[model samples]
Target: MFEFFPGDHVRSSSVNLALMAGGSLADIGRWLGPLRDTPEAGLDAWAAAWAGMAHQQEALAAGDVRAGYLAAAGRRYLRASVYHATAQRQIPPGPTKSESYAASLQAFGNAMDCGALPLVRVHVDSPDGTLPGYLIAPDAADPRPVVIVYGGLDLTKEMLYATVGAAFARRGITCLVIDTPGTGELIRLRGVPSRPDYEVPTAAIIDHLQARHDVDARHVAVLGVSFGGYYAARSAAFEPRVSACVSWAGSWDCGALWRRRWDEAEAEPTSWFLPWVTGTGTIEEALERLELWTLADVWPRVTQPLLIVHGENDREIPVADARRAFEAAGSADKRLHVFAAAGGGAEHIQSDDPAPALDLIAEWLSLRMPVLPEPPVPALA
Candidate 1:
C-alpha cells in the first residue's frame, strides 16, 4: 500500500482505503500535506482535515445542483460522501461519529439521486433489526444473479458500493452492499453487535432478495471483505440458499488474530474501533467475544463453490488463514488465489491495487452464477 503517512501503518491503510473508495491523489495530498510532519497530530486533527475537504466537496455539489449540472453535482456529492465517511473512521464512537456518518449517508443518497444511478436503498428484516443496504442492479429488466457483499471492521456499505458493488453491476449482476451487524450503520447507529451465527442475517437478506423481481434467487452468492471473510464463509456454510461464497482475504481464526495483536501491542487506527464494533467496553472484552468468530468448524460445512482470495503480503490477516480456509472447506470446487507482493494487490483485500482482484472476482462469479441474457429488442423500430 502507498504510505502517505510514512511510518504510520494505520493512516497509510486509511489512505489506501480512501483511494479505493474513489478519492483523488491531488485531494489526498491537499488533505494530508499539512499533517505530514506533525507527528503529534492525533485522530482529531486527521478527522478535521478530511471533514474540511468533505465540506468543500459538499459545497461544490450544492453549487453544481444550483446550476442544473446534476451529473457534476452527483460526482461531487460522491466524493463528499467518501470524505465524510473517511473522517468518521478516525473518530471514536460518539455524537461526532454519528453526525459524520449521517452526513456521509445523506451525501451518498444525493449522489445516487443526482447521478440517476441504478441503485436503491433497501431494508432487509433481520432478527436483530432492519439491516440497511444499497442495491445496484443492471439496467436490463431480466432477472440477474445477485451477490450480497458484507464489509468488515470499519468499512461501510457506501464504501463497498463505490469500490466493489458497482463493478459487479457493470458485469450485469445485481449487487447488494449491506451494512451487516458489527459493521457500518448497524454498529454505529443501532448498537447491534457482531454475532457468530451470520447465517441468520444472511438468510434474511436472501429472503428479501428472493422477493425481488430483478434477482435470480437460485444464483444468490455471498461475499465478505477483510474481517467479513469469516462472515461470508460462515454464512455459506449454514445458508443453503447461498449458491457460492467468496472470502476476500479469508480469516480462519479472528479471535486468535486479536489475541496475537493484543500480545504484540499492535498499533490500531483508533482505540475505540474494535470495542465499538464488537459492542464491548474494552479490548479485552472484544477479544473474549470474538472467540466465537473462528471458522475452524464452519469451514468444513461450506459445501457450495467457494473462492478464497488473499494478499501474499497482507499486513492485517496472514495469508495462512486463506490456506487454512481452502484446506478445511468441504467444497469439492474450491480455489485459492494469492496476490504476490511484486504485484499491486499484495496488501489487504488488494487495497494496494483493487482493479485486478475485482476483475478476477467478477469473472469467477460470472462463471458460477451465470448472468441472465437480456430480453431481445422488438422488431418494430
Candidate 2:
C-alpha cells in the first residue's frame, strides 16, 4: 500500500530490526550504507524514516526480520536519513497478563519494517461495545510509563509499530495499541462504530495498563496516530490517567480521510465501508456514522500538553488540521512541527527526509515529559 519504489524496502527492513532492538539499532541501519550516498535515498528515506509509523500492540501481538532484510538488500535507487532514537518497548511482569495468538503479524510486517511490541489481546466490557486491545508492556520493569496508542483508520494495530509504536518505545513508555471501534479488524470484520466517547474504551486501556505493576500510575500518556490522533486528543481531555498526549500526523477532524480514501472520487474497496463503521449504510450514511466520532465536537476536552506533527503539503489530513489543533489545544506547551515540504522537513510524515521530522519529535517530547537518564557531566578542563 505504501507503493514505495526500489530501495525504500531495504531501509524499511533495517529500521524494523532497529525498532525492535533499540540499543544495537545501528546494526539494522548499517545495511542501508550503500543507499546512504545516493540522492534518491533521501526521498526514499522520508517514507522509510517514518516506516516506524503505526500503533502496534506488541508489533499485532507483531511481524519478521531476516527475510525482509534480505529482500531490501542491494536496492540503491532511493534512501533517506536515519534520525530519531526509538527503542523497543518490553513488558515486565507484576499484575500484567500475557497471551499470544497465532495472529502475530510478523510475516505480514516483516516485509513492511513494521516492528510490533507484542501483547496479549483481551476483550474489555464496555457499555457501547466490547473493546479489544493489546497490552504491550513488560511485567518486571521497576517503573514504567503507560501509554495507550490508537490506530489510524483502516490499518490494524498489529501493523503500525514502525512509526508510532516505535516512537514511544524509544521513550521507554509501555504501550497498549487497540483495534478500537472504527479502525482495523474491529470495524472491517466486527460491527463497531467510532463512538463520540472514544475515551470510554480507552478507560479499559488505562485499566489494563494500571493493573500491571510495571506501569506508573502517575505517568500515563496517549499518543494517537493518524485517525486515532483526533480521538486521543479528545480522550486526554477527560481521562486524567492520560498525563500527556501527542497526535502525529493526527486528525483534527475525521470522515475527511475516509472520503479521500474511499469516496467515489477515490478508488473504493470491494467493501465500501466495513459493517462495523457503517453498518449497512450508504456511503453518505457511513459518513454520517463517522460523524459521531469527529473531533469538531470533542477537541475542547483535550487539555494536556499537545504535540501535533503534520506535513505542510499533506493531501489527506490537510495541514490546516494541525493549525486548528495548535490553536484549539488548551495546553500552553502546545506545538506544531510542519515538515518542510517533501524535499526537506515538510513531506508527509517527513517522508522525503525524515531526519528533521524525527528529531523534532524526539526533542519535543524530551522537553515536555520524558524520563531521561542522567547525562555524564563533562570533565573539567
Candidate 3:
C-alpha cells in the first residue's frame, strides 16, 4: 500500500489488495505521488489515479500480446484487472463505475488465456436469480476437495481469487469464488442486496458442486472473509453439506453493532455502507433491517468443525465479537485463533499480510479434505 497521503483507510486497503494481486509498487508510487496534498485526494481523485494505472498496464499488456510475449501480457492484464477493480470500489453507481467493472472482468479473462489457472464460469441456480462464480480448479480430470469462498461487503470474486484462490489452487484445492448476492457483480448488475439467510446461495453452490464430476462433493468447505464471516457461519449452521467452516474474523451480530452509538460501534461507515448494501433509502431504515443479519440465532446450530481466524486488532469487527461467536458455536471441534502483534495477520482479514493466516487455513483444510493421489499408471509389460 502506498503511504503518499495521510489517513485514508479505504484507499490504503484497496491498494493493499492491488499490490497483493501483483501490482507494481513503483507504478503505484508514480500514480500516488501526484495526489499528495491535492484537494482532489478523495474518491474521484483516487479513482482517477487507479484508472490511470489500469489503462497504462492494459496498453503494456496489449503491446506484449502483439509481440508474442503472451506470458508477460497475462501478468500485466491481471495487474490491470486488480487496478480497475480497486478503482471502482467506492465510486457511486454511474457509467464510470460500470466501465471500470467491465474492464476488470475483461482483463481477468485476458489473463486466464495465458494459463493463470483452469477457470470455469458457473451459474448456480438460486432463489435470487443465478449466482455467478468462477471455479478455479487444479485439474479438470481430478476430483478435488473444493473450498467455496466469498468476500465481504466490497470484495468481488476476482479480489477473493487474487487474495487467496491462487494459494488454494497451488495447494491442490479447487476454489469456487462467488460474487454471491449483494456483493460484486450481483450488486452492481443485478441490484441484489445482502440477506441474512445465506443458506439459500450456500445450498445452490453445494448442488452445483454435486452435479460436477471434478469436485469431491463429500469434502466441501466454506470460507468467508471480513463481513462474510457471518454469511459463512450462517451457511454452515443450516447447510449440513459444508464439512468444515472458516470464518475469517467472526461476526456475532451486525445488528448489535448498528444499534450501538457511532462512537462505540466497531464497524465504522455502517451508516453509509449499510444503506447501500440493504437498498434502504436511509441509514435508519438500513439499521433497522440489519437486525436480520445477526448470528445469535444461527451459531447454536453450527455443529460442523469450525475455524475462527480473527485479527486481534481488527478495527472493523472486534476480537471480542469473534469470541462471542466462538462461545456460541455448538461445534465441539472449534478453534478461535486470535492473531496478536507477534504474528503477521493480526489486522482486519490480515489484508496487509495474509500469509500467516492463509497458511493456517490451507493447512487446516488439507487435514479435513485431503487431496486424492494420482492413480498409478499401468505397467507396459
Leading candidate by TM-score? 1
Off by over 4 Å in 2: 1-140, 164-166, 255-264, 267-271, 274-276, 342-347, 351-359, 370-381
Model 2 worst lDDT run, 10 consecutive residues = 74-83
Per residue, candidate 2 scores C-alpha lDDT tens digits across 1-381 of 121234443334334423422212343345334555674555334333333322231232222122453333211100111112111111111111011111223233332343322445566666646666665554444555666777655445554443443454555655666677766546544557667677777777677666666556567777776566777787888787787788878576676656555654542422444333456456667766666556765666777877888877665577887888778777776777777543464544544455566556645664555554335689999
The candidate with the higher TM-score, 1 or 2, is 1
Give one digit per residue, the lDDT tens place, for model 3 in 1-381: 233356766566666667766678888889977776584557778788899999999899889999999888988888888899988887877788888999899989898887654688888888888888898887536788899997998888987877785667777789899988889888888889888899999998899899988787778899999889988999999998999999998999988776674546534643466777888887778889889999987899999989999988777788999999999999999999988867566778876677888888888887777788546789999
Instruction: For model 1, give the 10-residue run with minimal summed lDDT.
Output: 265-274
- Alpha carbon lDDT of each predicted model: 0.87, 0.53, 0.83
lDDT of 1 by residue, 13-77 (tens): 88889888888888889888889989899877888888888888989989999999999998888
User: How displaced is residue 15 in candidate 1, in Å?
Assistant: 0.7
What does the lDDT come to for candidate 2? Answer: 0.53
Rank list by TM-score: 1, 3, 2
How high a TM-score does candidate 2 get? Answer: 0.62
